[model samples]
Target: MSQSVHMSVLLDEVLTALGDIKDKLVVDGTFGAGGYTRAFLEHGARVIGFDRDARVKPYVDAVSAEFPDSFQWINRPFSEMAEGLADVGVEAVDAVVLDIGVSSMQLDEAERGFSFMRDGPLDMRMSIDGRSAADIVNEDSAEDIAHVIWLYGEERKSRGIAAAIVRRRAEQKFERTLDLAEVVERALGGRRGAPVHPATRTFQGLRIAVNDELGELERALEVSEAVIKTGGVLAVVTFHSLEDRIVKNFFAERCGKLPSGSRYAPEVKAANDPTYELVTHKAQGPSDAELARNPRSRSAKLRAGRRTAAATWSEQTVSGKPSTNKVRS
Candidate 1:
């Protein structure tokens, strides 16, 4: 197969965390251009790769042809891996690795509508089904739109942006990426020489809400706990603070690092034995060499854990106090 142009961030660190996986089962939860899956196969590991984007089929075909016996591809979201794995007669895997958020392939293709830098249909659905970003902006109420932008994008001026969208849509509904991006940019009073684009956060919010990215990540993390064998690894590379926070909290909770209540409040104890031991005390970021090679990886953070022999926690006991502290970039 031809080489992939898409770069897998923190590839060396992820491989190191997984240790020796030769002949072991590993799930590449976000296959993308088959970068990680190819690496795993090269290491002599058997891989089950999952991706929701149909556009990745060509890459999948190439990897399958080369590693016919060792590679398998599932064209569903990684959150459904447990059910997908059961259908393939696999009970558990030795490790599960996820590269979260939108893939570079989607971002680069203007037609995918993932980037404000390029104009395209306002479609950001990862599965190519369900609600599109155009649908949200054109049909949702101003209040609802503001909430989505604020909650998912973390944009401080979400209200003004939402109001601008509503006012503009009243004249003509938004159908193109540039039309909406322009509105958001104007709403924010132009870039004002900011390093990042004015519409970055607004686009991010719409994309997350459209794709249900956070919900999918949460479900995948939970399912992974059940499908990994004892001593198995669960490694995730997050691109932003929101994604990193979820991963950090999940690892902390599973590793028995439950949050202690305030001095006036009672301390909480784990109802079940810890399910994992943290592979790293703190999250790992890209090395200086990697940053120089791929500046896009600057925000990437990798967190991993090794499964313990303890039984998986019940739903009631699985809840963890959401971390109030912001994740350091």
Candidate 2:
């Protein structure tokens, strides 16, 4: 039997925040399953969807056949959206939406190696052109693996997990999801009275490392700011704390609130002026109704901001420095 997959995240919230784009151009940065793209089209907007996965090719073909030129699909990473858009003569868009991180479609497919629940080959590359999770697990050093699992996955038991994986791989190479999961489970036992699986964090860590997910997401955020026109909306749906931190900090820095310390110190003035006007004061998540329908929506967080008319994308600085935040620790 095969696993059933559904996109259990902030679908409606993302669409609502995007609001009215009739006859205007919009960019779907993630373009997984065509959810946001479809909504934009329904609003009478023209869309250019971007995805690194060649697996998306067929879906793109199907949608293009139905909508014709109203929707253009670009088979490229969101980080490269800037370059790809230029080739197509697209200078600016009315809005940009990015649903970051792995998708249910990728995980449910056993061959893709995203889910630790199912036994499958450890290959979690979003694009077919890169090195896979299998490659990293079977080859990376313990220190590197621990760092990735710790920083990207935020797994507290990273050292134990990495040591276990290294020891096991020395006996035999890790080839499948269950093979690695079992090692991690053996290394880090379940929490007291907790129901979460032990392998979850390790799997997430491996996937993020294999795909360079955070690095690409940060670059995409920068590129989106560059191409979205003034008054344009930028909505991002993040599934993890690391991603939420990036989104939170991005909005704060752009709105000139980056230097503020909560209940600790006075606000330090930013060296430069603000660029984006925050649309939401705090991050919004799935509504109670949506959460009832899809449990996965529980972890989803959506942050949105509107580009100021006088703002140039380059004008926004994160931490009073350029927006380069990658923690390999």
Best by TM-score: 1
By lDDT, the best candidate is 1
Instruction: Give lDDT tens digits, candidate 2, residues 238-283.
Output: 9999999988888887776765657597766555555578877788
By how many angstroms RMSD does model 2 differ from the true structure?
A: 5.3
CA lDDT scores, all candidates in order? 0.89, 0.81
Error of 2 at 237 (Å): 0.5
Error of 2 at 169 (Å): 0.9
Candidate 2 CA-lDDT value: 0.81
Candidate 1 residue-wise lDDT, 100-215, digit = tens? 99888888889999989999988988887899999999999999999999999999999999999999999999988898899999999998999999999999999999999999
What 10-residue stretch in candidate 1 is worst by lDDT? 320-329
